[model samples]
Target: MGSNEYFTEAVVLDKEPSGEFDSIAHLYTQELGRVSASVTSARKILSKLNSHLEPLNLVQVRLVEKNRFHVADVLKTGALDRQHLDALKLIKSITPEAQPDPELWHLIKTNLNEKDILSILGFDSQFAACLGCGLKKDLRFSINDLSYFCVACYDRLL
Candidate 1:
């Protein structure tokens, strides 16, 4: 492969229309943590890349980086359920670009829970207590505040 070309396993995070016939795909890749790549003519009706690059799909992708990254090819490897799609969204929200974390990648590739993901992001919940009631049990994490709150406290806030 050329120096500017990269091949990696990636999970599709999201996609958005770019111009008239192109799209910008957000991917969390095993080799490059997160990247946005342009897909030429991906908005067309017969776009093969568009179907393979749907949100939460696991794919092998070839990316060419010139002034910016562009998708050269993609092959769908797996499809994730709605629950996993939610996890992918959380991963996209937390991770930075081009900072690959093998542990995080493994967590995404396998059966995972929110706790595992939060731990990978350095927010361990084992010793966490409710911010309002100081109770650890039956707590839900608040990403907005980076705190845990018991069900009662959380319900009250909502």
Candidate 2:
């Protein structure tokens, strides 16, 4: 590896075409948190990173950090299902840049269930507190309100 280049495990969050042939990929890494990497010639037919750069794909990437990250190599790759990919998108949409949370990483690596979505996004404590004065164990999520409430509180609102 070059002096400036380093390898890290990352998950692809989004990608946007850049210039004519290059592309920029947004990644959430275990070490560097969220970063945008430049994939040179990414739109070309022979681009190796093309197959590994899709959303929700876990990859081991070699990067050099300058004004923006430049991808040197993609060492490995893993992918999620359509539903899990959607959940990952949701997670990425709300996540801020350069913030690393091991809990979130673990959730992405292990399970992609919607039930864990709230917690994975760092809303569990707040959701729990929203449930009937903050002491309810059987809290239910409310899509309409975008929060959680105990059965009694949920009933009262209805």
Candidate 3:
């Protein structure tokens, strides 16, 4: 049989330096859910793989399935164009290399495939509101700590 290749959206979870030249990518594929692959090194100046290797980028890569890992050939990239490339560059400049937000990664990959960026952002924002008798929009909650109400509402919850 011929090699199988996939055309799907993927989010970078983690990437590490493999062997002497190659690097392994822990990718979350829309079609396969989760997969691990070793990408060829883009060491030379003319390498297109250099730009495709960054984490947090929304990319579509063509890969041939192999015994050990899904071998990949990066077809194209820059989902966000040159005008929007500024946005990605800004985001990368602030975020530490090699780390990704697990929750955001999932949210981004799913929403991106569905083409519903606003919906996901809105849902995550409004879901923070607490279930209380008289709550306003200003009500603050820590999405991390699960803190949803003031001291008074905590009493009612008891």
Q: Which has the greatest TM-score?
A: 1
Q: List the residue pairs that clash in candidate 1.
A: none
| lDDT agreement with native, every candidate | 0.85, 0.75, 0.50
Ranking by lDDT: 1, 2, 3
Arranged by TM-score, best first: 1, 2, 3
Select the stronger candidate by lDDT from 1 and 2: 1
The top-ranked prediction according to lDDT is 1
Q: For candidate 3, write residues 66-125 as lDDT tens digits.
A: 554554565434443233333233222233332334544465534332212223334333
Clashing pairs in model 3? none
With a 3 Å backbone cut-off (N, CA, C), the pairs that clash in candidate 2 are none
Number of backbone-clashing residue pairs for each candidate, in the order shown? 0, 0, 0
Off by over 4 Å in 3: 41-47, 75-106, 110-158
Better of 2 and 3 by TM-score: 2
- Whole-model lDDT, candidate 3? 0.50
Name model 2 segments beyond 4 Å from true.
Answer: 1-4, 41-46, 125-158
Residue 149 lDDT in model 1?
93
